[model samples]
Target: MGTMEAPILTVNNLNKQFGSGCDQCSNPADRRLDKNYCPACGTVYSCQNITFDLHPGEVLGIVGESGSGKSTLMRCLYFDQEVTSGEAYLGPYKEGRSNLFRESSQQKRYIRNHLMGKVYQNPVLGLRMNFSSIGNIAEKMIAAGNRNVAAMEARGSELLERVHIPVYRMKEAPKNFSGGMQQRVQIAKALSNHPPILLLDEVTTGLDLSVQANVLDLIKHLQRELSISILLVSHDLGVIRMLANRTMVMLDGRVVEQGLTDQILEDPHHAYTQQLVHSLL
Candidate 1:
């Protein structure tokens, strides 16, 4: 669904370094084979000057090995972690004028509630296991200003049904469900606000292969049905190929390549990307 139209989300020159940009970090020579780590000063540029755009209804994939900075980038976008330096403008929020990283805490909360929804790699991170399944979804609705309990319950049930969760099981605790069912519940919570942008970080990471396929199918179905812009982070090339229209390959805190998913899979220009592509062959 990518288009030449203005992006729904824009991130320019994003950087997330652990240290204070020490003198050794500034020196290109001190940057070890691991691009993020410095030998002399031990500075870690967890995410190094990343940049990308996510258009309305587009599915953008960030693929990399674990700890390659893709997850760090996702964390920064979700405001779970602060960025070291960068400008992020959500077009559907604040009229795309203010940089998200610079907004006040209250303003950030508003933006999060109104403009974005996120599903973390772990269901525990995204869901309240102690709460009932519908109760978990209700929390997101409550944050978005919904006050009527009946309406929230109805809405939660609808979302649960959409995700293939049984309506009768809506009152059960997520901790009692299978991993796949728990993931579906988490997805329902993320969709509670009907946001224009959704951030998914390795949503299927720890599931079994069959469960992963089913969840991936649900994700594809949601993307088509909702037509929302998606920023998907995953280490699996198969997952990326299955869900992404455009793909960005990250390595050692840097985006080494970006293009259409097929283009990158068929002909990866970067050596790391080539190796990644071949491994799945």
Candidate 2:
């Protein structure tokens, strides 16, 4: 990882909340919440003042239990969900001066199609199950304004094979594939455009242990081979330990601890982080 390199992504004071905040919950200094939810106003803050920088070719893991807002952060970054308030900058986009969260819809779409790729926890969210696996990859390429059909087909096939999808199955729809295979196809599709940033949200969740291991290994291999910067979200510290150079621990929509993966695993400072580390022991 190039710790000294300029960050490919910078996020500042990102926040996402549901419902209009009442007086009690409006002020952060005076707010009282029950695990990210304000009982008085029924407002649920999915993310609060989140900030981080992802360096070029770095794997930044975000680990937290369900409802800890890790997934919400990924969604906001990928523009799958709107941020209530925040700013994100991508070095590969507009010289990193523009706030991604504030970009026009067309510009955001361009960013998604060119600068970033995301693999959702659910294949359904990331893939068109009915389309041919190779077609899914082509879809992203097409979105990025690639109209050369032969070139797209060649690139799509190459990516699928790189992800370990059998060449024979390139034309098959994802719905007929196993969970792990579907994820592999999704990974291939995400990489089709050669995006600089990849957002991976629980990519290996819900698979059999063996299947999960295979997916994780593929991710590790691909990350190294492509030298891509990844923003990975998962509840599994084991997953974080294997792939992340640095880790951030989120709890109740707030980041409680963050540091090198080894340091956090060895000497967790926050109580919640301590619990998470101990559980991995």
Candidate 3:
């Protein structure tokens, strides 16, 4: 990303806590740092003072091990969960100045409908197993206010093809499809509105290596085709390296390090990140 291109999304002082704070749990130092557990009251702090900026058309990867806050952060940004504090501003909203965290429910719906798309780790989370694969795609289009059946189905069919699902299989239920195929359907549906930003959470986590490669290749192609920004969260550093321009290393509910994907992999600054890099060797 060019230095001159303003960030499309900026997250500042983000925090997600599971329990109400108590006097014993309140620590000023903890407020400024990442602490997943309160020493005094045992509250779970899922995310702590996390901040980052995603430039337009860039793929920002969040990498971490299981139990790290990568998925939690993604969930917060996409509004699948609530944030305890801080602000996330989407530059494209309100002429590049709306704080998404401060948006009303109706306005948040508008932002979700118009600006972003999300693909979850589980295909079931993103796709309706009982619905026809094509219908799953149209569901998003309909939610976005497209009422014309012909146009919606046509658009769905077009996206199915784009994701490498055979157009003939569009009428089949995703429940009957292979996991890889189901994921493809999820991707097609996510792209229904051509969102500027896509949030992907472990889209290829369970697939076989070859299948993962195919899915990854498709994503790479779509990034080029659509020029969309992506916030990709995965435990796999290989996936992050392949997809992200910038990578943030997360550990125990916070970004411990962040830099160019290549640089981060080649020369990790944090001990946790170093351990991660070595483990991949």
Q: Which predicted model would earn the best TM-score?
A: 2
Tens-digit lDDT string for candidate 3 (139-233)? 89988889999999889999999999997889999999998998899999989998899999999999999999999999999998888999999
Q: How many angstroms is residue 24 displaced in model 2 relative to the true structure, after the best TM-score fit?
A: 0.9
Model 2 alpha-carbon drift over 4 Å, by segment? none
Name the TM-score of candidate 1.
Answer: 0.96
Per lDDT, what order, best first?
2, 1, 3
1 or 2, greater by TM-score: 2
For model 1, how does the per-residue alpha-carbon lDDT over 7-102 read when each residue is reduced to its tens digit?
999999898988765665775455553566877777788887799999999999999998799989988988899998899998877688889999
Model 2, 156-191: lDDT tens per residue?
A: 999998989999999999999999999999999999
Which residue pairs come into collision in candidate 2? none
Judged by lDDT, which candidate is best?
2
> What overall lDDT, based on C-alpha atoms, would model 1 receive against the true structure?
0.90
The Cα RMSD of model 3 versus the native structure comes to 1.7
Score every model by TM-score.
0.96, 0.99, 0.96
